[model samples]
Target: MGDGRSGGGGANRPAWLQQYDLVGKIGEGTYGLVFLARTSHRKCCIAIKKFKQSKEGDGVSPTAIREIMLLRETCHENVVKLVNVHINHVDMSLYLAFDYAEYDLYEIIRHHREKLSHSINQYTVKSLLWQLLNGLNYLHSNWIIHRDLKPSNILVMGDGEEHGVVKIADFGLARIYQAPLKPLYENGVVVTIWYRAPELLLGAKHYTSAVDMWAVGCIFAELLTLKPLFQGVEAKATPNPFQLDQLDKIFKVLGHPTPEKWPTLVNLPYWQNDQQHIQGHKYDSHGLHNFVTVPQKSPAYDLLSKMLEYDPRKRITAAQALEHEYFRMDPLPGRNALVPSQPGEKIVNYPARPVDTTADFEGTVAVQPSQPVSSGNAASGNIAAASVAPSRSMPRSMHVVGMQRMPNAGISGPSAAAETKRSKYGNAESWLSSTEEALLRKPNGGHTCLFEIA
Candidate 1:
């Protein structure tokens, strides 16, 4: 069996960990490393997110606690399911096991652009958008707001009963906005800079679910064009400075926001401070059709326009967007985003996510064996032979660095040079743009741990 233990063998490992075999390391972020593992009984693949101990020598990190709290209450096919929670009693590290998703929108988009040298099929795009909206609608209906909505966070199931289903993952920045004890703004900046809402960029203390819709609009555009709609360089500063470049990118295509367009525009903290730099710029309001390839009169364009409306109050709700005529048009959205609704349409086979066998579950580098360890079976044996001591303290502030993927061999795009320049801001990172040092800086007594299965 795969060795999940530390310096000692499997006998020294916790009882809860012995139930599964670590296949390989799949992803690594600010909080911890994610491993692909197989349950001993069912032999089904699962993603285990192992969070480092709190910096204060405390127990679990607040981000992990918050994710468990929010995910336990939510049950939907479109949302990623939290399977189990395990604790390494020896080190007090937290591990969250989730249903493994084999594909994400980022990889899929890159595949189409770099490998296939074509656009994603219209049916697949519609299905993905519809499913994303459906999941966001459920979250909104329950008063939750997924502050970070991006291509990498949107996951697609691999070969299984739920194949091609979209699962919205990552709940680190999610919060319940309904009847908050304190303004949601107190927690600091939220959402990745590229997909941030206009009101958020303008420093609006009081915001609504419309912010999520705006992100959905950006994702919809990316689904169509296979690129970030607003790929602007993020400003790295304390207290979350206003992202002028990001806002400028949005305004160039959608036009500058005015008090007439957004009634509450004058009340925002930044706008109220007489920011002459914002008012000095003038942009054409009808430039969206130029950026996105959709027909001006098409229902798809209408839905996108409504989602990207300058005023949050005027923005279309997820429930309302689902009923829009775009979905009602020819070749309706299907249940499976990867499968074609009509027969005889070629199915696009997306490559599985890459796994790094050299990285151990303990977030330490290990030597690769002479013969590669098989990822398919549990008894193939563990690769973590050498144990590297992990740091007890982690940085208080965390920023999610984008997971790098290997491009298909011998396949290059025509705009590879342009893409390389944009990759610095667009693909190299998935920033949270937080104002405070800690991700969840609030006092922790209010949230109860709900998903501690182990």
Candidate 2:
């Protein structure tokens, strides 16, 4: 149980956090460093987000507590699952565990920009966009506003074919909406600057889920363009940093913003004093290789334009976005093919966190070894008894065939004798635990793999 805190070199994870067998650091942020950990009983890998205690704070920060509370209250397929929470009594610090994923959307996009077959396809764009919106829909419906919505926060489940099971993670910045507030008018401030909605920039004091929608719009634009649509370089190292060309790039391609399209411009807290405005420029294919098509108005582009509306009011609802013709055109393929390092992967990295493998009955350890089940003795008229040998499929590792289980076959099957479908905890004579049955059984047509934990 390397709770991550220990003799300090980096941040010391307290010994109380040692319940998890720590693997390696997956990520770090202002608050806590993330670790990959596994539980003893369950071999499930979970992402553990350990909240760092602020020297100034009297106790766990209210923000961390709020995040845990909100995450526990909301759940959705598009949203990352909050597995559990651990509070160290010794230090009174808190840790949140979540389902581990292979990578985030940012990584996937960076790696497969040109490699993605659906780079410019309306079908693929629509599907991914729809998933993003669906997750947003769930959050907004619960009255939750995910203040930060960036590609990095949206994670891709695996590197396999089911690559786009995007889960919205990182709710530390989220705030519950009570009423709409005035939009911020600072132009290039708040949240992630590029994805920040106009209202936040305008200094809107009171806001609603629309803020998140605006960020969603930015993400959609990025997925299609590969490059961030509204990103401008910040003035290096100055608190007075400003994005002189905040809307320059956005307007340069999409055209100038007008009171007509965005009538609320005058109402923004930081509206320009000058009435002068810019007009749309001719579209250039500067960074739009496989990410976008040559023609801007392709179905995907049209859909993107709708999502990225400057006016939060005009921004499409996640549900409505899902219904858009794009998702209806081509349903995303099944998950088995898309997830790269699925349960089958030998050693997969998970977010460091503690998860209850017993709750799901899928003891953490993945099925790699064949268990020996005793069939009635050959002399006991059990000659007809047969068992399915376990199979290991590895793209990089050599394939090994299952060996004939003779009477002399030792309890632990040798690696050389690979079994395709052998029962776990070998020994059919060994009683099956409820957990094993649930995890190892074929639910419907697919073999179910529970989330791994340490």
Candidate 3:
């Protein structure tokens, strides 16, 4: 839409919908409906995404247009390939075609969660982690930021050796940072709450590809633990701009964000509010190091630390993460995610992910009007929060970048002058400490943090 749109017009090809036989609806969410279809001529399966038009007479949404533009330029094995596009002239329905993916990281993680005995092996974990980063590296290298990178959005091939190949799917939330037509945040919130980067959560206007790195950190943690690192309820956008509860959840683990630690912390629009919310929790790190139960004494912790660094600028880029000692150690990450079994180890044929042929997607937000949630379990309060329909939230990360994006300096973050104007926290010695170091340094009584570095 902003000079990047290749404009794949559907004027010439009429009756495009007739070409593929709709097998059944695969999925539906924020973007639109995904149908499993087979080409009439080739007989191979393909995914057809029917883009929803605005009900208020607005032609096609810019988000759909942006997706078409970004996917047109992005060509990588790790990224989903845009196969074909169709536009009905009369009703003006826009549809995008893609190769069908059999599994998403969410399904894989949930499968292991469901079956304790069928836990993913160590080599499989490393391979999936590596493939995820490899795809992410390709995206960041091209100056594009995948604003939304949760487990659900990362797809996996389901057959042969290619079955292990992970593909970065759904560009509806992805934006190119090539050359700027406007500031990144001008488009508003881009990422999902659980995987959102610290800078975005704190209302940083001009963010970098490090935002994607932060999400990668969360995904990496989920791969090891099978649960989100910082799973918190999203704050209502209109009533309150500040996400206190979410910030509280993060500080409970990562400790407080300060100027000494993150020079640009004070410059965030919501910094003072975050400071207030995270105040009493300082030095009260709620033993989160014990929660990230990954392999002990491995380089995995080091890589994760860099990825989840409080300062977005300090977070590991996808490229740097790939080269870290974690990937080099013990069971080196195999090219295929489905690693061969050892001599005596029994192979677990992890079942192919289930595809719901008749799942209803008409109602984006579903309320069990008859069935009420039990007040006894407070954890179930946020269950329906994630189901909110995706709307026209313009992402800040979409602006075009003229040059290659590089990691920022540790002191002042991605952009020094842009974020930190004056030092708010004057105590410089506190900079010597990190939250992870404090939590993993020793056990308070009998509980030891299993992720303690050697």
Candidate 4:
């Protein structure tokens, strides 16, 4: 831990303050910094996610809270594990400790691209895809939508044994879509621009996990081709109703969507208003056949086709895709993606993760290391719930994704005396020990990989 002391009087800190020794800054983001740490008692490795106050100088940011709650409740091998949480009484700062992972899909793809000697084999691809889908299926089945699903957000353990154990990290933009208290549309401008679904770009008020599925389809293509299939320049924010440039990029490769293909297509705000300007109708003749050249006629193509289906309702469900013929093919999916199929084949070597011991966490937010420009970025922003427009979908009394409480329920915060209240942990300041897992994961120098030190 650099300096170790975080603001306020040194000795007069919360009980949890002395529990761990901070190591070094692993990564930084808009909200805060993630540090590699170990517990004082057991010396178990942990990834501490520290969040500075929001602009108003309040408690934890709502986005951080959403992540804590989601990770705490979710228990899956493929999902990042949240070990414990703590709050600085003096500064009102928030911190979450999670199990550490080694590598991310972003780094993996970059490694393959930059390296001349090696490439990701097909068996590894099948394995990584299977694990990713497994985690995503868990999220969707729980009614939670991972609004941002890209290479960076998908983590892989560098433990060597669990080669295919991909942990879906970053829940800052994740929300439970079950019977939402506010219209799902209220959370506008979600998912990274590239992975964003066609329906969302068209300004569809009502959408579902299919949006996530669409992103997965994009990811699937990227893994196969070692590049983003639809690398559209993100349109600058505007008051207008459409993202014409992004839509055009998709149409140029996948062909224009017709009313016959997606029944509700014409009703969407962007498509209805700007149908005249949308170009590239002729590209539909070949569909995805022309775009994805490496993957030939197989069940993998079937799964990709279903995932990229224009009609979201018809998009392949996570469970269904897992059972696709693509997975059942000869090089059947494996548990260890990195393990070579042939016994004598070499185990791919990836670089070690860099640690910035000098990154000060005493004040301000940490910035992630910028990544090299590829076809486009993997992910960056998620503007859900920042919309200026009134929600168009019907509101209900149940839960809404990313919201602290039900709509109109009022502000949510813990009482100053909340320590005296009964909690899952004995006191408000508590610890839930995780295995403190640290695999050999690395981040590319070019990309800004953030969240729980994955």
Candidate that scores best on lDDT = 1
RMSD of each: 14.4, 18.1, 17.9, 14.3
Tens digit of lDDT per residue, candidate 3, span 1-454?
A: 0111111222332345555554456677786887666667776667778777555545455676667666765667788878886554344356788887667788778878886535577777777787788778777665567888888888876543354577899888777564332477877777888888878887887888898888888888888888888988886754333566777778877777778989988788887564445544565665445668754455887788788899987778887877787776656665556535244444443443343433322223222222211111124443211121123121112111232332322333323312321232121123213322333344322222112111
Per-model TM-score, in order, reads: 0.80, 0.64, 0.73, 0.75
Give me the displacement of residue 350 in model 3, in angstroms. 3.5
Summarize candidate 2's per-residue lDDT along 200-319 as a digit string, tens digits.
554554456777877877777776667677776655554422343555555555555567888876665445532343222333434332344435655556666677677778877765
What is the lDDT for 222 in model 1? 92
Candidate 1 wrongly placed segments (more than 4 Å): 1-9, 369-454
Error of 4 at 425 (Å): 18
Candidates 3 and 4 compared: the better one by TM-score is 4
- What local lDDT does model 1 show for residue 26? 72
1 against 3, candidate with superior lDDT: 1
By TM-score, highest first, what's the ranking? 1, 4, 3, 2
* Order of quality (lDDT): 1, 4, 3, 2
Q: Could you give candidate 1's per-residue lDDT for residues 1-454 as a string of tens digits?
A: 3364422246655566777777677777767878877788887888888887666656556677667667776777888999887655455567889998878888889888899888898878888898898888777766678999999889987655676789999887886555423466876888888899989888888788899999999999998888888898888874763788898899988988889878899888777664676877677765789989799999999999999999999999987988888887766776567765565566666766666766666655556532222223223444221111122121121111231212322225324422432443231112222311233343442222224543
Per-residue alpha-carbon lDDT of candidate 4 for residues 303-330, written as tens digits (9 for 90 to 100): 8889999899988898788777777665
Deviation (Å) of 208 in candidate 1: 1.3
Error of 2 at 152 (Å): 1.2
